[model samples]
Target: MSEPARDDASRGYRDHPRSKPGPGSITRRLRRHRPHYLTAAAVAFALVVAGVSAGVQSGAPVDSAAAAATPSGTAAASPLTAVPASPAPAASGAGRAASPKATPPPATAAAPKAGKVPAAVAPAAAHKPAKVPAAAARKPAAVPAAAAVAAPAISPELDGQIGAIIAANSAYALGVSLIDLSDGVVHGYGVQGNFVAASTAKILAASAYYHLVETGRASLAAPMGGTTAGDQIRQMVQQSNNNSWALILSAVGYWGIAAYAASIGITYDCTVNLLTPEEMARTLELLYAGRLLSARHTAQLLSYMQNTNFETLIPPAVPPGIEVFHKYGLLYGNLHDASILVKGSRAFVFVVYTRGLSESDMGPRTRIIQKLTRTVTGALF
Candidate 1:
C-alpha cells in the first residue's frame, strides 16, 4: 500500500485533475445509493405535477368568482366601452329563421346627474319597423283638402239683367259702372271705354286746389279769378264755370294736376281730357270715403255738388229720400254723368259715359241713363 501511494509522485508524472473514478468504484457506489436517488427523483416529479394542477384549479375558481360578481344587465369588459350594442329583435314567422343562441340584453347606462344631459342610447329592438318594399316606400302621401274660395261680386242673374238692358239700348256708345258701397263690389259693362271727360273733369282742378290748401301752400279765402279760392272752387264744381276752371288750371300747372290725379290713383291726361266710367266712379268713391280732402272741405265740396246747376241726368232719377251729389258733362258727341247716391247707412256710386249724342239735345241718352239707374237700384236694393 505504501509503495502504491508514492508510485506516481516518484515517477516524474502528474495525474489529470479531471480523471474519472474507476469503473468498479463507480458501479459499487451507484449500486449502493441507486434506490435513494430514484426515490428522490420520483418525489420531486410528483411535487411539480401537484403544483401545476393546483395552479390550474385555482385559476378556474377565480374566473368563476369574477363572473358571478358581475351584474346580469352589464356586458363583459372589452376594449370598446363607449357605444354599447342594441339587443337583437325576436324572429317572426314570415322573416328569416331564428338564431340558435339567445340574444343578450342591452347594457344598463348610469343615471345622469341633475341638469346634465343623458347619453345617447340605442333604440329598443321592438320599436323598429319591418322592411318595406321599394314601391311602397316611394308612394306619395295624400294631399290635404283645399280652402273654400270667395264668391264673385256680380251674381249671374243680376249680370243677365244688366246684359239685357245693355242689349236693348245698343244704339249709343255707352260705358257704365256701379259700385255697391255695402260690399265694395264693382260691376260694369264697357267700364274701360274711354270718352271725352268734358266738364266732369272740373273735379280734378277743384281737387288740386283743395290739396294745395290742405298742405298750407294756398288758402281757401285767397282771391282767384276775381273771387275767393273757396268761391271759385264752388263755382267751378257747382256751375261748371269754364272761366273759374281756366283760372284754377293756370294757378295749378298741368304737372300739379297730373301729380294730384296720380296721388288719387288716376292717370289723367290734361291735354286729351279723356276718362273712363270707372275712373269717374273711383274719384267719387274717394271723395265719399273722405280719402280726398279734409272733413270740412269734403263736406263743403259735397254740398256744392248736391245742388249743382245741372242735375238733369242722375239727380232727377234718384228717389226723394236718398240725396244725390252729381256732375254732368255734355259736349258735341260725348255725354256723361257721375253721381254718388247716399241714404242713411247706405251709399252707391254710379257713372255712365255715352258718345254719339248732340250737345243741344240729350233727351234719349238721358232717358237711357235714368232707366239704367232705376234698373240698378231695383236690382241691388
Candidate 2:
C-alpha cells in the first residue's frame, strides 16, 4: 500500500530532526501559535468591553447587557432584560461610541390646541402657604365710630338775661317778647302779662278796617266818622291821630276788632285797651309774614308804620341799615312799643310794654325799653 505525503507546514509545525512527536511536541506547537490565540482573546475581551460601554452610553442598564449575553432563556425573562434599551447614537466616524455621561436632549411639553386655553398648573408644594390658627382666622377687624353732629345755635341764656333786666327795672311793671326769625326761637320774660295797649291798639283797628276792605264788606274810600276810612287809617298809623283812630275803630266796631283778633288766633280786649306782649309780637309776626294782609296792603301798612310821630322806644335803639316798622302807645301810666326790625333777609318782632309811670313822665320806662332793645340786638346779631 502507498502512504500519502503530509505537509508539516499546514500542520503548523515543520518537521525537524530535533523535534519528536510527544507531549513536548504539543508544547512546541502551542508555543508556535501563541500570538494568534492571544490576538483572538484580546479581540473578544475588547468586544465585551465595547458592549458594556454601549449599554451604559445608550442609557440601558449595564446588567441588561449582561443578561442579553447570557445563554439561558431564563435571562430573557429576567426583570433586567425586560427593560427597554435606549436608542443608539449615530456612529461618528468609523467606530466612535457616545460618551457615558452625555446629557440627553430635554423632553418638550405638548402645545395646546388653537382656540383652547391650557389648564393652570397647581402651585408647587414648596410654595404653598401654611394653615392659619382657628382663633386668628375667626377674629373680626375693628371698625371706627361715627362722628358726632353739632347742636343748633339756640340761646336759652337769653331768657335769664331778660329776667335780670326786668329785675333791674323793679319799679315799673315790664313785659317783653322777641322773636328770632333766623332760628324761629322766641325769647322773653313776662310775655303773657296784660298791659295797657294804648294807641298800639290802633294797629288792631287798622287791621280790622283793612280786613273789611279785603272781604268786600267795607270800602277804603267810603266816609266813616267824618273822613274816608283810608285817610283815617293812614292818619291813625302814621301820625297817631286819636280822632282818626276813633273814626276807624267806630267804622270797624269793637265786635269787629274782637272777631278779627279771634280769627288771627289772639285775645284782645279792645274796650279796656289791654293786650299781652306775646299777643302784640304775634300780631306783628303775622303782619311781617304776610299772613294777616295781602302783599300790597302789607307794604302799604308797613310804609305807614315807618318814621311815625313816636320814635322813642325800639326804632331809636336799632342799628343803622336795619328798617324799623313800629308803633308806640301812651296812656295814664302805660308805655309800650311794638316793632318789626329788618336787615337784609332777616327780621324779628319785638314788643315792649311797661306801666306804673305817669303819661307825662315816660322817660325812665322808655329808656329801659331802649336798653333792653340794645341788649337783644347785641345778643343776636
Candidate 3:
C-alpha cells in the first residue's frame, strides 16, 4: 500500500503534458448502466419480431435467421432452408399420412368421366326434334278435297253415251241440252248453234208475263179479256195452242220477250226467233231454281207442262207415272222436244232439237230421240 499509494499519488500529481486519460472510469460507468442497455436491446428485438410477423402475414419474403429460430417461428422455414438434417422420419411419416388422405380426393375428382356417357346418348334424344316437323308435314294431304270440289259434276259415262248418240245420228243437225240438277252437271251437244226455239218461245212469253206481274205492271189473277192470265198461260203451255200463243205474243210483243230473256242471261236471235239449247237449258234451270217467277206463277207454268199431248221423246223412256213436263215442236221438217223429267224430288231437263231426218216423218226422229233418252238415262241413273 505504501509503494502503490506513493506511485498513485505520484501519478495523480502532474504527469507528462502529452499523456492521455485512461478508460477505466468509462468502463465502470458502463457496468453501472448495463440494465438500461438490456432493456433497449429487448425492445429492439420485440419491434423486429413484430415487423417480421407483419411481413409474414402480408405474404412478404422474410430473411431473418434469428426470427426464424424464435419460439414464435414463421412460415419462412422452407425445405431448402431450415430443415433438420436427421430425426426427419416423423415429418416424413406425417407427409405420407397427408398424401394418402389426399389420394382419394383425386380419385373422386375423376367423376366427370361419367358425364360423358350422357353426352354419347344425347344424339338419340335430339331425334325427337325431327319428329315435330313430320306432324307439320302432314297438312298437304288434304289437297285432294280441294280437287274434289273443283271436279266436273257431269258423269263421264253419261257424257259418253250422249256423245255417241249424236255421232251416230248424222242425218239431222241435232242440238241437245241435258242438265242433272242433282249434281249440277250440264251435258250440252251442239247447244251453241242457233236453232229455232219453236214452242220454247212460249216459255219466254210466260216469263215475260210473270216478270210484268213481279214488277206490279200486271197481275196473274187478273183477266186479260174473257179469262184470267192463268187460263191463257195454261192453254198456251199445255195444248201448244197456236192461237193462244199468238194472242200472248201480240200482247207481250217480240221485244218484251227478248228483254225478259236478256234479263235472265239468255241469248236470243230476234230475227229468226231462235234460242240455243244452252240458253233454253239455262232458262229452265233458272225457272226450277225459282229465279224467273214467283212460286204461284212457277207452279202454274210447270203444272201446265205436266200433261202434254206428245209423249214420243223423253216421256216414254222415263219411269211410268212420273211427271213428264214437256213441249214438242213440228215445223218445216224440224222436230224438237224440251222436257223436265221429275222423279221423287229430283228434276232434270233435256232439250233436243233435230232437223233433216231421212224419214220425212215424225216416227223415225221420235224413235231416235227415244232411244237416245233411254241410253242417257240408263247410263246416268
Candidate 4:
C-alpha cells in the first residue's frame, strides 16, 4: 500500500503498544483522525509563522542616540528636553563627539575668570549689556555728570533782607515767591502757603480760554455770555469785573481750572478759588516761557495785566519807566499781588500774598505793600 502510516518522533505524536492497539488497529484510528490532525497542524503552522514575524519586528535595531536627540521626531530637536535615570551609552558617546567643537567660544569669553586677561577685557566687558548687573548700571556716563552740576548760589545778604522785612511785618502773614528768570535763583520766605485767589482766579479763566482757543476747541470770535471772547477777557483781567469772570468760569467750568492747576503742580481749592503764591509765580513763568499760550496770546494777556486798574502795590514801587505785567486780588482782609516785572532785558516773577491784616485802613495796607515791594526790588535789582 502506500508505505504504511508514518509517524514523526520529533513532533508530539507517539506509537501505541501492540497489546492495546496494534499497528494495524492504530493505523485505522489514525486514518479516521488524520483529517482532524491535518486541520490542527495547519492552525499551528499559521500561529508559528505569525510569532516569527512579530519577533522579527520587535528585535529590529534602534538608534537610541538619534531618538534622544529628536524624541518628538522633529529635525531640529533639544537634547535637554528630558534626562534619563542613567546615561545612555550611545548618547554619551555621541556627546563626546560634539564636545571639542562646542567648547572654545565660552572658554575664550570666560578668560577674565583666570585674572590674567582682566584689564584688557574689562573695558570691553564693561560696555556689554549682557553682563550688566541692573538697569541703573546701563545709564550713560553723562547722566550723572549732568545731575552732579551744582545749582547757582543765592546770596546770604538777600536772605537777610527778606528775613528782616518779614520779621518787621509781624501783624500780617506774608508769602512771597520770587524767581529771577535770568539765573533761575528762587528766593521766597512763605511761598508754599495758600491764600484767597479773589480776582486772580480771573487770570486762570483767561488762561483757560486762551488754552482752549489755541487747541482749536474754542475760538476768540465765539460769542461767550452774549459777548466776544476778546471783550470778556479784557473786562475780566483789566477791570477785574465779576460779571466777566462769572461768564468765563461758566464757559470753562470749575473742573477746567482744576485741570490747569494740576498740570502745573499747583494745589487748587475748587470751592473758594484758593491757591499758593508759588503757583501764581509759576503761572506767570509759564506765560513768559511761551508754554501756556502762543506768543501773540501771551502778549495780549500781558497787555491786559499791564493796564489792570488795581496798581497800588507793585507798579508804584517799580521804576516808573519799567513795564509791569501784574494782577492783584483783594478779598475781605486778604491782599495778593503777582507780577512779571521787566526792566530792560531782565525779567523776574514776583508774587506776594498778605492775609490777617485789615483792609479797612487802605492807606497803611497800601503803603506796607509798597514798602515791601521796594525792599524786595532794591535787594534783588
Candidate 5:
C-alpha cells in the first residue's frame, strides 16, 4: 500500500541483524530451548559464593575496624615543688604555685648561691673567752667601716626640694618625698631616709585592694563585716574612712591589717603607715611613668584616683590640666599628711607630711609643699 514502508524495513534489518544479540522476539521459545544457558548461570553463581567465603576467612586486619576496637592510654603527670622566691611575684608568669615537694625537671632546677655575708659575720670569735679581757679585746680592729655602696637613690637637688616640700606642708610628717616620674630618680626630706605613711597608708591599701578587685579575687561591693557599721573597715581602711578603718581593725584584730599588707607585697610599717614623703613620691612616680605593671593598669589606677580628698597638695600647686588624685590626712592641724596621685603628660609622687603642733603651723607647711610640687610637676608633668 505504501511501497512496503521503507522505515519498517530499516527497523527490521537492525533488530534481526544476523550477528546481533537482539532482545528476545520469542521468549517462550528461548526459555524452552536454552535450558543449557540457565545451568551455566547457576554454576557461575556458585563460584562467586565460594570466592566471597574465602575472602571472609582471611586474618588480615582492616584499618577502620581495628582502630575502633583499640583502647586509649595516658602518660603519668606530676605537680611542681618548692615555694617561689622571686622578687615581685615573678612578672614573667613562669612561677605559679607548684608542688610543695615534687622535684622539678633538671633544666628547671637551680641551686641557691653562696651567701654574701660581711667578713664581720664571724661574731668577735666569742669574746675569745676573755683570752685578753672585755674592753681589751684589741677593739676588734675597729671593725673596718662597712664598704658603703652608695646607691644613688636620689640626687642633691631633689633632696633639697624634698625637704622644702615637707617643711612647707604641715599635713605631712617626717618631711616630704619627691620622685621624678620622667626618670627613676627619688628624693626625700624631713626624716629623709626613714619612711612614714600615716593616713596616707590608705594608698597602699587602695592599691592592694583594687588589684584584688580587678583580678576577681575580691569584690568591692562585698561587705567587710556585714552591712553594719563594722563593714566600714574595708571601705575606710582601703578607702581611708576613719570610722570604717576602726571597724576593720576591730574585726580582723590588730595584726590583721599588718598580715594583709605583707601578703599583698606592700611592706607596711606601723609608724605613720611608712609614709615618708620620699616614699610617697616614689610610689606615684612608679605608677604614672608607665613603670608599673601594664601601661593600661597604671593609667586605669591614675584615672580612679581623681576622687581623692586631698586638694591643697599637688593638684592645686601644679598648673591647670594637671590632675591630682590622692588622700589628705589631718587632725585639727596637729597632723597633716597629703598623698598625691598625680597624672597627665607626666606622673610623680609628692607627699608633704608633718606633725604640726598647732593648726596655724600649716601656713608655712602649705607653702613649702606647693613650691616643691610645682618644681617637680613643672619639670616632669
Candidate 6:
C-alpha cells in the first residue's frame, strides 16, 4: 500500500518549520552538516574551559583537589577565599556555560573576606586538620629524574689541538678517523677522498707472498744465493729497502698482488701501486681482527712488518714503549706518506701522505703529521 509523504512542518519545533526544505536543498544539507557542527562546537568549548583553568606547563586544569592533599587525611580548618578572577579562556571565543539558580554558599565555602567584593571562589581546603600545621608553602611538584644521560660532549680544547696539528703538518695529506670498531662508530673524515699509500702497499704484497710461501707454491726459505729469499723479505720490510720489494714483487708475480689483495678484502686498484686511505685502513683493521689469516699467520705477519727502524716517521710521535706495526715508502715523485698499523684493544689505522712538496716544504708538514698522530692516539688510548 502507498502512503502520503509526511511534511517537514508536521515535525516538532526541532525541525524548524520556517526553514522547511526541498529534498535536494536545505534538508539534505542540514542532515549532512548538523552533526559535524555540533561535534566541532563541543570540542571548541572543551578547549576553552580547559584553557581557562590550565597550568602553563601542563595545560591540565588546575587540580585543586590533588594540590589540596596533605600527609594527614583530616579536613583543614579553613577554606581560604581567594580572588574570583580567573585566567581567560581560549582566545577563540566564549563557550556556553551552565546557568544555575543563585543560592547562598554553604558554611564550608565561607572564608576570609578582603576589601569589599562579591562572592569569591574559595581555595581548596587542605587534608590535614587544624591540630597539624600545613606545609609552609605548597610544595613544588616532585621533579622526576631525567631518563636519558647525555654523554660528555667532545671538548673544544681537543678540536683546537687537532686544528693546530693539522696546520703544522702540511707535508703529508695527514688526517684521522675516530671509530668505535665494535659498534661501527665513525668519527672524523672517514669515507672521504684517497690518501697516498706509500709503503703500505707492501703490506698487501707481503700478505700475498707469504700466503704463497705457506702453501709451498712459493718458498720463503728457498736460497737465491747464500741468503734465503724469505730472509731477504724480512730484511726489506724491516729496512724499507727497494731491492727487497723488487724481489718480492717478482716472486708474487704481477697478477699475484691483485689476486691476494682481493682475497684479503682490499678491493681498490691493486693493479698499480696506488691505494686510498680507506682501503689501507680497512686492510689494517681486517688484519687486526685476524680475518686476513689464521692467528698464527697474522702474528707472524705483524712481527715481520713491525720492525720500525726504517719506519722512522711515526715511531717518534708515539711513546717509547708502545708497539706499532707500520711501513714507510719514499718515492722520488712525491713526499713520503707513512701508513701506521696500530694493534691491541684500542686498534687504529693511520695514514699521513704528503704531496706537492719538496724536502724544504715537507719539514713542517711531516712534523705536524707526527704531532697530531701522537696526540690522537694518546687521547683515544
lDDT of 6 by residue, 1-381 (tens): 235778766685375687776668977788999999999999999998877757465754454563466323333323322222232211111111111211222223211122212122111111112232357335543532231222212233444566566555443554444332332222343223554555667777777777887777887778744587777677667776667777887888887777787775555454457765555655655554455554455555566655556655676777754455666666543444334333332344555555545556556655665776677666645
What would you estimate as the lDDT of candidate 6? 0.52
Provide backbone clash counts, one per model: 0, 0, 0, 0, 23, 7
Task: Rank candidates, TM-score, best first.
Answer: 2, 1, 4, 3, 6, 5
> What's the lDDT for all of these models?
0.67, 0.68, 0.61, 0.64, 0.46, 0.52
lDDT of 1 by residue, 79-189 (tens): 123223332223211111212321221323211112222231111221123355899668763531121122323345555665566667777777777665534445566
**Who wins the lDDT comparison?**
2
Candidate 2, backbone clash total:
0
TM-score of predicted model 4? 0.58
CA deviation > 4 Å runs, candidate 4 = 1-154
TM-score of each: 0.58, 0.59, 0.57, 0.58, 0.45, 0.53
Per-residue lDDT tens digits for candidate 5, residues 1-381, read 124446866566555557664578578668786988888999999999997787688853344443344433111111111112221211111111111211111221111111211111111221122144667555654432232212222344444554444445434544555543333334444554444355666555454544555566555566655565323533553356776555434444445556656653345554355544545555454344333324344444444455554466555777766545556666554344444433322334566665655667777666665676676666544
User: 18-102, model 2: which lDDT tens digit per residue?
Assistant: 6657768888989999999999999999999998889689995445466556664224544324544332222222111222221
Q: How close is candidate 3 to the true structure, as a TM-score?
A: 0.57
lDDT of 5 at 367: 64
lDDT of 3: 0.61
lDDT of 2: 0.68
Better structure of 4 and 5 per lDDT: 4
TM-score of 5: 0.45
Q: Write the per-residue lDDT of candidate 3 for residues 329-350, one digit (tens) a residue.
A: 7677678888765444345677
